[model samples]
Target: MSKILVLGAAGKIARHAIHQFLGQEGVILTLYLRKSGRLQKLAGDSVEVIEGDVTDTRHLQEVARGQDVVYANLAGDNIEEQAKSVVEALEAAGVGRLIWISTLGIYDEVPGAFGRWNHEMLDDGYLEPYSAAAKVIESSKLDYTIVRPAWLTDKDEVDYELTQKGEPFKGTEVSRQSVADLVVKLAQDPTRDVRASVGINKPGTDGDKPSWY
Candidate 1:
């Protein structure tokens, strides 16, 4: 069985991912959270929980050791530092696969009027860190798939499409459920491979006018 470590496991997206992975085949999940108290809702022997800050290299290394794949959902003002810590820990632990979640505007790939507003909302300060973090992952020797979702929504539906490192997909929002589904799919398939980034969003939605806008 493949052992997977999920950083920022208390997050909304990670919660959904956990729901999807549980009871699935050939995989066991270990959730890493800064505060184990926040993970009370997920308490169960079936799931392993590790409490630690992502910026702490030693803690990250301990959690990542012997894991086959890692899914990073961490976010904050010091996101780049967190990414650096995880990358270093993964390298030291010899863990190869990583699935990193970042926002679409990080690369200015968002299109249309709303996309413009999205960039304004993110500003350069908020995105600069993620961009820097992505550069680190892109240059690393580890196999990785970086997923940039257009905008996040709490919608329960899973209808979505992906734009793979080509044209940016047009849509303002994607549900947490859909993103979780994609992560689970990626975790199961080694064929997803290294150093690739893709954009994800719901289909049949207008680029200029998203529901949230």
Candidate 2:
């Protein structure tokens, strides 16, 4: 069975990914979050939920042990610290595969007016720490795929496309479900996109800004 540990499991995207992971065969998930009771109803044969802070490296290491993949869907002002804790914990636990959710513009790869707008919106306190966090994950020896998603929407559609690191980010936004789909795909195949940072967005949605903005 594919034993997966999902950090920040209560996150919106992680919740979606959890459901998708359960839909697959031979996949067992351990959901790690600060409040286990939030996902208590999901605990059962194929799922296990635990309450633990990812910043607690020792505790995280214990939970990560024996897992084939670690999917992190985390965010906040102290995101870099969280990334450090996750890397340290994964290294100590000897788990090498990681799938991290990050946002677009971390690399200044989003071009033109839209890129400018993105910076204007995210620069205050969001982008800097996220960029630092991505650097932490990239510097680690773990086989990691950093997924940078475009402006996210609540749209339920799954249409999306990908762009690798160094390529210009496409479109202005993508559905949250599309990002969740990509996370599940990476979890299912560890060898795909190792050590790569990818940008995901919906095709034809390119604009100076997301449609909703």
Candidate 3:
């Protein structure tokens, strides 16, 4: 059985990831949230919820210990600090696999008119923190997959594309469900071993590239 730790368990995409993990065999999920009250709906006899801040090393280590994979879905101004805490704790515990959720414009992958808006709207003091967080994860020895998803929508669709590292970012927007599905797929198929950073977005959408080219 694989023991997985999901940080930022209260997030929009994290909710979908939790849904996907349900009923999967050999998998025990531990959801980490800042406040247990926020995740009241996520709890059951099978799911374990841990309350702790990611920036606290002691709390992070306690939650990360004994987990085989850690899925980080955290977002915020202090994201870099939180990521550093997660990386350090995982290293101390000898956990190997890390699946990090990042935004599309973090790598200048957004294109065209909407891309410009993304930059104007989101690219500020927040991005440098995310960049620093990514650096720490990339430098770690653990097997990692950094998933940078395009503009997120609440649509329930699963149609999207996945591009490998160094490839141009595709699509203008992607559903949170699709991102969750890909994360679950990566968890099941270790052979993919997509170590480098990759981008995910919908196909045939405006201001985006197709998933298959």
Candidate 4:
């Protein structure tokens, strides 16, 4: 059985991941969120729901104890600090596997006209911190997979592709479900993309910018 803890469990992507993970047998799940009411409906008998801030190392360590993998679907202006806190808590708990959801432009991995547009759209507000968070995750000895996804959509589709680190990131948009699917796969195995940063998006969706942007 795989033991997993999901941080930022109230977010859209994490919510989807929770639903996906519920379908698996022999997978034990713990959900960490600021408020438990939002995801309470999905808790079922298979999940343990806890309410707490991810930045609180004490709270994080409490929930992360005995977990084999930590999946984070978090976003914020202080995301770097949160990431650092998570790393600290994981280290304290002696847990080593982490799967973090970041964004594509963090590494300027997006190319051509789309890259320029994405940068202009996000400015430094999102890029700087997310980039810093990635650095923190990589700097730690934890077995980590940093997932950078292109502009996310609410579409229910699951089709997506991965752009490995050092490769130009592809596509402009991908579904939230697609990102969740990848997280589920990593959580199940926890060894597929250890210490690797991956970029995800739908193929052929690249353009000057995401259609909605």
Candidate topping TM-score: 2
The lDDT ranking, best first, is 2, 4, 1, 3
lDDT winner between candidates 1 and 2: 2
Candidate 4 local lDDT, 90-198, one digit each (tens): 9999999999999998888788999999989887587988899999999998999999988889997999999898999999999999999999999878669999999
Model 3 lDDT per residue over 44-117, tens place: 76679988888888878887888888999999988888888888888888888889998777777666776777
In model 1, what are the clashing residue pairs, if there are any?
Answer: none
lDDT scores for all predictions?
0.85, 0.95, 0.82, 0.91
lDDT, model 2, position 206: 82
Candidate 2 is scored at a TM of: 0.99
lDDT of 2 by residue, 115-175 (tens): 9999999999999999999999999999999999999898989999999999999999998
TM-score of each: 0.94, 0.99, 0.91, 0.97
Q: What is the per-residue lDDT of model 1 for residues 123-156, given as tens digits with 9 covering 90 to 100?
A: 8689889988998888888899999986788988
Q: For all the candidates, what are their Cα RMSDs to the real structure?
A: 1.5, 0.6, 3.4, 1.0
Candidate 4 achieves a global lDDT of: 0.91
